[model samples]
Target: MLRVLAVDDEKPLLEELLYLLRSDPRVRSAEGASDATGALRRITRALEAGPDGDDGIDVVFLDIHMAGLTGLDIARLLAGFARPPLIVFVTAHEGFAVQAFDLKAVDYVLKPVRPERLAEAVRRACAQLGRATEAPAAAAEGPPGGPPGAVPAVPGPPGVPAAHRPAAEVTAADRTPEQIAVELGGVTRFVAIADIAYVEAQGDYARLHTDGGSHLVRIPLSTLEERWAARGFVRIHRRHLVALARIDELRLDAGTTSVRVGSAELQVSRRHARGLRDVLMRQATG
Candidate 1:
């Protein structure tokens, strides 16, 4: 079991996080703080009280962007402490993964927090704390045909079930697929869109490369380019689609441009080089 302190400026998100954390069997207690200042105070008190004390917090799930002091600043401060709680950064932006890595964070969870995703973070925290844990049952509470942690549908007017409601009444999020389905050895499995680092085209198929492994899908690279464009994926080459957020380095050697994603260094075609550079520059500046 773990004692957690979830910190976020938004009241609704903070409450939602607390609810999810409490539901997890691995959690002993879940607490909340509105801002970094309050979170730091609680952490300080916990440290003073010692590890076995009831006031101690085992982990802190913190939001990256806040009003006064950012999560990174708080992490730096905690790093100096003799004994600091484990950190898990929760944020809407995907640009802070590197900073989070440098800060030695346990996990980096994106916004619109999914139950299964958060469960994985908790699992990592448990591992670091030398506690063994089985897979989380957080997804068990999710509605059928929806991702874990998705809100349940509300009933329609006049005692009608929500499932019988009109299509127009459903939100866009309900129609979107957060994970991509791929078939391997006659077994079909889903892959989270955020996990894909890059896509490589192979005639009629596209290979989705993730940190764990790669999966070949029937979708074309061109199709993925248009569909994932809004998701920070850019066409770096005719046969390659790279996720902007996953780009670790951009190199220009002898007038040729290339970008590094994970352990792979992908070449940027001359036609798309300028476009890729522009997008990356904009992201860096902003």
Candidate 2:
């Protein structure tokens, strides 16, 4: 069951949100806090207690305007932590909507909440969690001959729950579905994930290969492996994680296997050979 914390200076509103959150069977428990200080204390204590010690909180419903340390401040503080709960802004003011999105907030609900809206927000939060958790496996399953970001079209509005409406529509504006930041000649460039062919490891950094050109990033290959592995990248070698579709050919040389990607030939290490073979075999049969 999902756990939640609702923070608002207004007593009645807090109670009302708590009631609505509790109505969902998926929500195991909901805690209410009237101020930012108290909310921080509660969160810190809960974290100290550990996951098994307490039921644990999955999301936070925050009010932007509060007596002290505004909701944005609270969100920033939570963001500083190792693992922060998904934040959903609950506010009467609409002005902060843009700011809320800047923080990548899970959702924003207007004051005097409606039951359906609140329920929808919760569902979206859950769906985001599922997507995050399943990304690596999904990335590993992309067609053997497709680009790394090649995903079966996520069926449209009906396929996604109402809670995910905003996210679903995001691709309309940007063709690339995932977020990517690249650095070139000391200038950082933000590229859409869709444009990337594959990300290659370059020592401490990883180079992002796109239709345009290749750009370098400071993030470790392992980190990218974990993050994009779910999207459609497979580690053919320690230094290479190629987009399955970008693979032009796969040749097994005695006991050694080599995959042809774009203009590069990436060797599959012994450790990854069997897994890569199985993935290719499954894609071929499917």
The prediction achieving the highest lDDT against the true structure is 1
Candidate 1 per-residue lDDT over residues 80-178, each given as its tens digit? 987899999999899999999899999999865666678789889999998866554433554223333344334334432222233333222232457
Prediction RMSDs, each to the true structure: 17.0, 19.2
User: Tens digit of lDDT per residue, candidate 2, span 101-179?
Assistant: 8888999998656555676687788887762322223223321232343334333343332112242242342334476
Following a full C-alpha superposition, what root-mean-square deviation does model 1 have from the true structure? Answer: 17.0
Query: How displaced is residue 29 in candidate 2, in Å?
Result: 0.3
- Total clashing pairs in model 1: 0
Estimate candidate 2's RMSD in Å.
Answer: 19.2
Q: Candidate 2, which ten residues in sequence have the lowest lDDT sum?
A: 138-147
Q: How accurate is candidate 2 locally (lDDT)?
A: 0.69
